[model samples]
Target chain A: MLSLEYLQECYGFNHSKWKINGEILDTEKGVKRLTNWTEEKRVRWHVQWRDQLAEKTGCLTNRMIQTIHGERIILSDAGWVTLHDEVTSLFSYKNRENEIGAFFGRYFSLGMQDVDTEINDPYANNKLKIYLQQSFLTKNSTEEMRFLEGIRRESRLRYNKAKEIKEKAGGKQEPIVAPIRSLDQGKVVYGQFYWTNLKGRPEKGYGSLRNVLTEWLQRYGQTSLFSLLNEIDKEFSLKGYHGKNLLAECLTPWEFLEYVMKTRDVHEKDELLVWKEKLTYQWEASRLLVKALGEWLDVAQEKVTV
Target chain B: MTYEQPSSLAFSIKESVWLREGEEIDELLSLALEPDISIREADDQVFIRGSLLLFGEYKPKEQDSNSNSYSDQISFRSVEEVTMSDDGIGMIRHSFPLDVTIPREKINRLEDLYVTVDAFDYELPGKGCIELEANVSVSGIKHERTEEPEDTYDEQQDEESDDYYTRPQEYNDFSSEREEMNERSFHFEAVREAAADDETKDEYESRVEEIKGESKEFQNYERNAAFEQHYEEEDQYEQEENNEEPVSYNTDPEIEPEYEGETEPEPEPEPAPEPELVRSEPTVNFSPQPSPVSAVEETHELEEEGEEEAGRDQTEKSSSSKDENALYLTKMLTKGDQEEFSKLRMCIVQDGESLETIAERYNIQVSNLIRMNRLNEERVAEGQILYIPVKQTPTSKS
Candidate 1:
């Protein structure tokens, strides 16, 4: 957090006399009578500072200013300050009533622009300092874009997590209770109960592994790890299926590891190690995918989580 | 019944005939009056008797050659009749005997008892003459009678006497002496009699003496209770009076205070003993006296008791008589004092103290202080002071 005292210290200035348009000007009177200062007087002061700073630097594009905190350097063109692209995008200059004067004063006080820009000199060096300040330091547009990008990336990760889970389960067989005999083929074959039942088979079943496993998981997942793994295997047919057949394919990496622990008579330590390795590999792969996608999408990488 | 004079008149005059020129003659007549016009019904009719004078004018026919010779042919006839009828209206009919013979010369001559006709020669075809007859007849009528009112003074006097006798005579003496003596004694006797029987007077007196001692002891025990109750009651009365007074006073601020706290109980006991003393001593003095004197003495005792009770009541009321006045004066004084004090405090604070410090010292909110002084909170400077109200601990949150 920026403390009020620090901001005050950084911006504080002492009243002083200076020469403007070949005339001595009192800083106190200038500040006090700022409302009464004519446009001519302001322009005259601007030109005086422009010539004095330009004579010392011998370059108009880049100039240094003295501020309360330290010396700041900026780019300018002629005497007009230039803003950075990010900063310019954050705050529009079109509708600003006092854009030039406010930008000059702000940059001048902060010492982030050349003194030639503060004097309103039309020089390339002064323009360079204005451009840099407007594009980079003056407005915090990049931070805002990063914040929005983080939100978008987080939503994408959630979407992908759900999508991955969906794809892993896409080719699994629903379940079959009895063999289906096709009238044209004269043979019995394992098929989903819904298809057999629709074909008017006599032994159509009312319950399936998916329904039972989902019910069991919903009831016992929080209390027992063994039941949770059992339900997962039964629902996915992970223990019974392997290879690339569409009706009964092997479980995806995460699901297969879960299946091995449920079906094999393994010690608890072995199952944990298996689960830990699979999870670590899945996490690493997910992180790399997220990082590459995030960059391509111009989004933040903080979105992807397990 | 009251009678008012008739303020309206109704009358009509009808001629007996349309007279022809030659048949005109002098007529002697007696009028026939309708029946039922008698003295008993006299109020129904009005009578005006007088002679009617007839004046005649003659004009000769234009077709006649003697029109210039009849210049002096005009004549006058006068007749008199006594008129009596209801509301000045009368109807008369004359009957002539058919067998009576009369000479033509006599008919042509103007007679006092013959009918006469007057005619006019005119261009119109209708009859231009009407006949008049004179006959002798006696006529009379009965009229409505006016009644005389009966006397009721004797009956009213008798009723007044009876009404006077219905009321009790003793109230006079009761009221007369009631004002002369003390009312406290009278009420005390009444209350004492109502409380204790006559045969038990001696017993009651002794019992009362015992109770007096007991009461004094009980009073010591109940002193705090009675005092608390009295104080609480007084406080409640004061608050209610405070509310009633201002509302009433605001409407009519100059109303007297004695009317406000008239029922308060301060001087009641002083007159209490007076009735007791009067009740005990008066009957003793009247025991050997005559009946009238004893009656007088009894009445005197009653009056004395009444006066004593009244005096005690008045004395009791006298103390609180000033209470309302005092309260009113105090209320006025306090209001004025508060306003003046607030003004002075505002001046003092405005001279140099900060509003926040003043608000803190007075235990009021800074916002309230600013509002009271009508100052802007953000722009207020040091030593730009404001009014600090004397804060009261709130009794309840609204």
Candidate 2:
């Protein structure tokens, strides 16, 4: 519901560029423009603005950018709010069939080959349009781990704050849990310049929530601390995932995980005997999750409308 | 029994087809065309699948005007030939797939097809795909199967020879005035409105017919004419003679052919085309851009000639009157005829020969004539020399 007028007047987002990415320049809605070569000179001002929000909140967060009122504007200062856990399992090297197979899900689409591959081949000698920079592959790449740790603490704190506010108001209002909406129609191939966590940020920021979660597991070591509560069964079921008994009312990610790990007893004859593997990190998994939590908020509409 | 005379017909049609146009501003820098062609014949329909593989090294344009910009374009194109089945319905729908329903009735074959890039450029300044507009010319050729009487061979040949001259859009700038001039009198319409004056319709048409026949003969005679003509001649520049009596095109051209006796065995020079900038090599020692005369004033001059012709000579068929007929037809040359005439000429600019006199003789722009030969002076003394681009004729070519 935030208006560009509010963005300009209040936040001083006066820059003509980033505030206009995916903007419907023509009066007729038929033409959609992507300023593919804009090089982030204009949009960086807005991203820097988001950095200020992070500075004030003391929590690093990314904006969910989209088009409304025929202009591309940030909907929320935080794109990732509600955390998901299974996405980390998907990114695990143990789960994948091949060394590079883990990168093939929603995140890995089209990308330029390595610089050497491009130099040898006559046709494609240009730098990649979308891919993680080689610098991320270096041995001491702990920046990703730091990013995940920051988000885990931030989400746990936010969930606790939302619960406190709800309890204080006698449970009359909904809690603050931000879910994700797919960027570029859930496409990662040739992702345009606009699909970034912030201006000049790598496209890894805009990968599918599952893909980004997997990336965290590879770089930050396996963790399930960020999974939101889901429907998990007692003593685990044959489905391996006990999502049936996962979500508990008004609890944060790691809080719900700790509750499940403690309640589910180890029975020798249980068909889902391997449920302990997911809880290996005990109460310290730190992955992100996203779902249609907005559906839960509109409880009346969901019950009557199909 | 009717004898079938071979009819040469070329069909020209325009169709808008999608072309593969892209621009990689940061990568490979050149433009080349590669095509994948598929020809399929299915129940009364021919489907042609065509994909163009456009690849090239793209050198970024020089940002500064003072720098060299020699690598502007690379001449790269791919042409493919595929057999298409003609449907019974003569209407063909040609798409990028080249999927078309070609009428099988009259078309003997798709003799030749060529595509020209009519217009192409970048629509956006910064980063965007290139916009290319190409004109695809598909010539569906058919032959006339009608039989001719043996005695009428000469008459039929005259009529059949006209296909050599009917071309599209190559006219002098002033030729646009023809449509307006045609409204003044229908008789002028029959003249080469392209070259038409206030002459009688019969006289003009007859003259155009003569030019067509002569041009066809010249093309046949000088197939390799462009390669062999190497003659050394001094520069012959003449000053403008706008002050003198306007030269009439009604002079007996056969009288001018007396000079042909001197260069009888030399190779005939073909017409110099305009926009010679596109060609790699210059054809003429000095290339003068040809210009047709303005109609309003030229028409008035022609009306005077027409009256003089009517008073002095009759349109008789005697051998004596053939020169008059030649003179009448020489003025109404078709597009191809005009091209045949733009050959190199070394005119010893005599005392009376002025700029207009030589320009009218060559049928080229007086300004361009001056620029091409680099005419240095305003006045022409005896033997001051000029390169008059006289129209090549049977007599002139040797």
Candidate 3:
């Protein structure tokens, strides 16, 4: 799936045009809209806010160290230490009762081994394929296996949606070194949920995934994503699936792979396969965040009041 | 030279996501579908990479208000042979196979698919399937070359070539031509002086000898008188001026000789007979410039230049102001260069006024207005703005 990050940054709703049509969903307080802003003013605010969001989240990658000419480096040593530590700690658990739990735990650990050439660690592009032949991917047998499959199936759908958003924004996902099946999040699930300020919370006012991301960035400014990525070294961002051209400005997921390989100090292809689970979890986590934010703040249209 | 060109493919592909046989759709966590296509030329093959981007909130039959959607991507890769243009300019097309379906059989794929515009996502409230449209285009693009290559310009060769002109020649030719023109007046003066009275050689010699003898006697007498006065006044002036500082000598005192030249004793030499004018065809240019050969002759020969100039002056003096204007215009045209001292004046057409009439009133050529304003009609309507050249008649040069 693609990252809707660029679109989120570029597009914005005309919130200044929003009128208070009905009472706020949770309270009797009527929806308040400050519509004194002109289109230019609103757009300016959105662009600036998006920039702030990108600064906090989009600036860092596990590939290489980026220089800002300011005091802040793109990725810091402290951030890398945190990310490596967190991934190894959180992703190294044994599978629990959940059918796909073991698979998730084994793949997500940041301490991945060097992959050999002869082994299979599918190159990570945005596109992910599921090999149902793997017992963990298909829902069969017990109810637990079925639950794992359902989560994966949903994750896959979300991943594609994110991918579409990425492509629409005139970009592609970075090459990742993992299995297609690993992209599904049945293995590791981070239970963090947030609410959006959109008109229809549970129903259809949810704007496009891109719209949601943009709203999220507009509201929170990537602070959550920053925390999610767990920071990395600036030097770490310099390495990725991208060719020698080092643009630290572009934060790609392949930077995760680079971080994994380097920190683990492994080059074996099979070792890369173990990462599918963790990378998949990461992708799912980001998608959920984007979706959550998209729903809460999608103010593009007028919806029926509760 | 392989230059990248961007071409867009406008195609529509449609697919549907069918809910299970007896399930009502409700709320989706996320709903998204994006169409994507990529171009890759590798390993002696050109392939198109296509994928479907699907994610978020899926409510198939509206059974529940807060249901979640599946998130994943469907991808395909293939290549179809496309005809390339000879000049390599048009039609570098590559098509790849694409297939998409929901994993849970919540959506059923359509058979005999003839759908285009495959990018759309919406709920099928009572319906079993979520129909999606996929329509995306591919465009070929070439990266811009950053640095501009230097042009292969050769100045020396351009100078030696006949089809070119250089700036240094303009400077040199302009100065020398101006000097040559100035010499024409000098030559005219010489010619005018030569055309004076004639006398025999014997008479001229006798007259010169007589004047020389008289001049010698007059000079000797004047010098002897001056020398005596200087000696006598030296002692008196030395003490009187020595104390006051040496008196500066008055240099080159003017002497006025009486006008006795009414009848000169020295006979003047005879003027040369006027040369017969040779008649030659004048080379005319399609434009107003005079032929180079005739121009050169006019500048070099004083008599010819004088004759031509005299005729021109007489014609100018006799002409009326109107005719003078015409002459001035002709001269201006022949010069082929004029500065725009005034702007191109705009005029509005009045009712019942035609282009020809307007031009006549302004004393300007109708064709000029047409060419300047790029008009196709010979007539203009009232209040229509027309841009005409300024009709500023040049004042006569002093």
Candidate 4:
């Protein structure tokens, strides 16, 4: 909803100089895009991070653009406005997983020291246990109910194991600025993946590689995931803190917890059946992810001896 | 594949190809899944014969053109290197052979041959032409025949040649060899003799100090003279070469000539005439360059320059060279700023013109052209109203 005059005055554009296509401005200088994010600090961090990322790797990111006023974010009637170059070329980690993996691997090696945010504990929420205690006092004889007992037992054991791993990590658990869904192909343009919406998580330690792996599972599945890991391993040497932290995250039973939370408020008997299928499906998917991660760990362990 | 010996001949082949006219390349997906290679030996030289199957997507210049996609099996009977460039809109394919000499020991033991296209690079240097370079390697395996049992062969050879080790009666004849050894001084006697004839330590040290002092004085004199000469020359040069505009110190050769028009040329009052849509053979300028390290600090400073006076000051300093232009686009591309060195100009697609050529002209990507136009495919016809992303100021045609 930015006025044309505002763009002309602030950006030094001649009146009716640039063509507007939705959120993108096709100017003689280059393609400029309007971004939804407005926070100054986060926007600045993104600028710095992407700048450094491009400096380190040949790959470029769609970072925020500065206005003619020497400002990255300008206050306008439609909230704080930020612009970025909209790269629409199709470049994904599909066949080029190694390159994508190498990108993240180099990112991990960059070390996210300046990223300021609270340490997110992946195991901080105990809502699953609370939900199970309240909703499952009696066996409802549903298909989902039959698996709940086993799931609860397994989740408890896995949760404790993760806790133990974190305890071992202790003071060494350094938070990293991790992309929420970096593996998503929709964000990639011209071989540059959008490394935006970064969050700090100490649970996965530096690079937040565990978070990336989980995101990879959700988007790309396990196929060629090892190749991606191998590429990352080549760049960042995902041993010690990165390796152990990722393993710990892999052990977390988020699938079960997510299922419990999804059906937590539902009291109707009929609605439970639909949720049952999803729970079982998520449980199996989570297991496959865990198994794949375990195998990668085993191979990595063998490599240590070699 | 069987070989008589365990040796192989390796061939390194380099080839370059141009994209067909009217078609612009978007991205090279990959080389073909398998390579078809054959090897022949004649006149003590090995010949590698094969075709490289290149898989990629190409955008035709004309909408509704049949050749929307590009996949080619480029055959070659080539020497070590082959380079070809032609002017037209038709697909041009050529091949060369690489002659590999087999070592004498393994010449006759050739068995199996393998070829792989290991490296590739492409450049869209204006025009709808994509210059592709592929580095292919062909190697032949040497087959080794099974040998007779080592012990038996050794025993048989020993029996055949009874003079394996002769116990000579002249074993104690060290006198002949001893004389030569005794004459040669293999120790540090020469060092002792040189040291004996050297100057005294005090004299040497004082001489060293004198030399050092003299050198220092000479260096100081040279430095002062050079500085004075440089300033005097600069004063004279400034007086002689003074113009209305300030001098730019930017010396990047790749960028210097590009912006020569920027500062020198007057803006044309009239819009440029639309270019004819004639199929011009893409000039095969195959120079692959690595992106140089940008002056990021200087760029950040430039970004903070919003005022007109500051802008003039910057223009005086660098005049917005291609590096700066690249940095400018890079900044925009990297989500940095809406700064402008050039403005977008509307361009009409000439005949045999592809998005690649248009992008090259603008120094942008073909994909960007597709995105900016929101075209379903990277196809454009003559007189198509496509926006050139960044029209270079004082525009120079390549």
Ranking by DockQ: 2, 3, 4, 1
| Per-candidate TM-score against the hidden true structure | 0.12, 0.20, 0.16, 0.38
Predictions in order: lDDT: 0.22, 0.25, 0.25, 0.40
Stretches > 4 Å off in candidate 4? A14-31, A77-79, A115-121, A124-135, A139-150, A169-171, A185-208, A214-223, A267-281, B1-398
Model 3 misplaced stretches (Cα beyond 4 Å): A1-127, A132-140, A172-288, A292-306, B1-125, B128-398
The CA lDDT at B369 in model 3 is: 53
* Candidate achieving the largest lDDT: 4
Better of 1 and 2 by TM-score: 2
- How much is B272 displaced in model 2, in angstroms? 20
Tell me the deviation in Å of residue A47 in model 4. Answer: 2.9
10 residues in a row with least lDDT, candidate 2 chain A: A80-89
Return the TM-score for candidate 1, rounded to 2 decimals: 0.12
When candidate 4 is compared with the true two-chain complex, its DockQ is: 0.00
All candidates in order of lDDT, best leading:
4, 2, 3, 1
TM-score of 2: 0.20
Return whichever of 2 and 4 wins on TM-score. 4
